[model samples]
Target: MAIISKLTIISILVISFALAFLAFYLISPLSKEQRKEQIGEIISQLINFVLFLWLAKILLNLQLFVQDPLAVLAYPSNSEAFYLATLFTGVLLFYKRRQKKITGVLLAHSFLQVFLAASFFYEFIQFVWRDNPFSFHYLIVFGVLLALFHLLQGRAKPQNQISIVLAVGAAGFFAINFMLPYLTLFGYIMEPWFLALLLAACFGLLIKDPQDEPHSETH
Candidate 1:
């Protein structure tokens, strides 16, 4: 019974994630082939992040992991692990881009859309099914991000849109996290340092010339 319940939960989560990706793919403005490739890359990046997160969680508690591996594995990942995972993933992304496996603009655009879509869906599910009070705040937050990104698509340069959105999102998160002591998304409270790093990364990406990006949009 326990095994079956775990399997069911995993299956539901997979389906929900697939639906989120599908929603982004359907509404994307990129060409069909471009959209497909971008979504594929997004999935690959997400997998990389998850794998790093798992590894970081184990490493964060070396003593516990050495004593009781099973118990350590069963425990939830902490904020420090989350930050380490994000840092490792960011490094991996930089390496991939250097290898010409990733394009700056396309990755930025695709990732933002998929992130917002998945976040909104997760918050909606939490609000409706779990009656989480924080979920409503997150839903409104993500909705505003979606609307802001859409508004920027027309007014802002394609190269600048992602940086602008990322900056704004990080700032918003910082404010919310400061005001709400129990700030959490997907059961992990974000550390301020992570948001600060995101802002720094956004600034770094902002300086790149879009023309140099392989998948850069001229329009």
Candidate 2:
């Protein structure tokens, strides 16, 4: 069982990398030098994130590490490590954006595209190899929404397009989990209806235009 679990993890990682690479290739319109620089930045961020994860794991299991440092190396990271890593990465990204080291909108656009592609691939694998009916349904819905977003992107401003894609992706995620009732990373089941409502609110907020705001009436 352990070997099977390890193999599954390896397979998923491989697939995810392949999907992300394919996404970057399809969505990036930058020159060769620009692409190289972007890839380098992404790699650096990933390395930093990995280090943060390791640090988080060590900190979370300080007692175990203190008792047997070698044994700590053999332990798999728990949910706390992942949560800490995510929070740390989010802060890092925010700081970089604030410092003008990265363009927030462009980064969001790139990541959203990659996420959409990766999600499609994940759902495709689940449906085809795992014979999951819900995954197949999710694939169809997600694929159609993503296709529509891409088709309409050229018609809108770049920022608006990014927001549309993100909103759609969020909606797709909510819809899929609502239909399937998947557990959270911490192994707790989330309320599907609550998630659906939350995503719906986000969708509405994203689609709301600043220019559409009502003007104050003068006496």
lDDT, each prediction? 0.75, 0.62
Tens digits of per-residue lDDT for model 1, 1-219: 766755654564566578778987677767778888888888888888888988998998889899999987776678888889988988988887777677776687778877887787777777887677777877888888888888886577656778777777876787788667766766678767766867788567656655645343332
Model 2: weakest 10-residue lDDT segment is 210-219
- lDDT string, candidate 2, 1-219, tens digits: 876866775586559657766667656665555555555666667678778888888998899999998777667666567667766876787678667677555555555555566667776777788676766766776687668657865576555776676567566666666567572322223455544554554344344334432221212
Q: What TM-score does model 1 achieve against the real structure?
A: 0.86
For this target, which candidate reaches the highest TM-score against the unseen true structure?
Answer: 1
**Model 2: how far residue 119 lies from native, Å:** 2.3
Q: What residue runs in model 1 are displaced by over 4 Å at the alpha carbon?
A: 1-16, 213-219
Which candidate achieves the best lDDT against the true structure?
Answer: 1
For residue 6, give model 2's deviation from the true position in Å.
2.2
- Candidate 1 steric clashes: 0
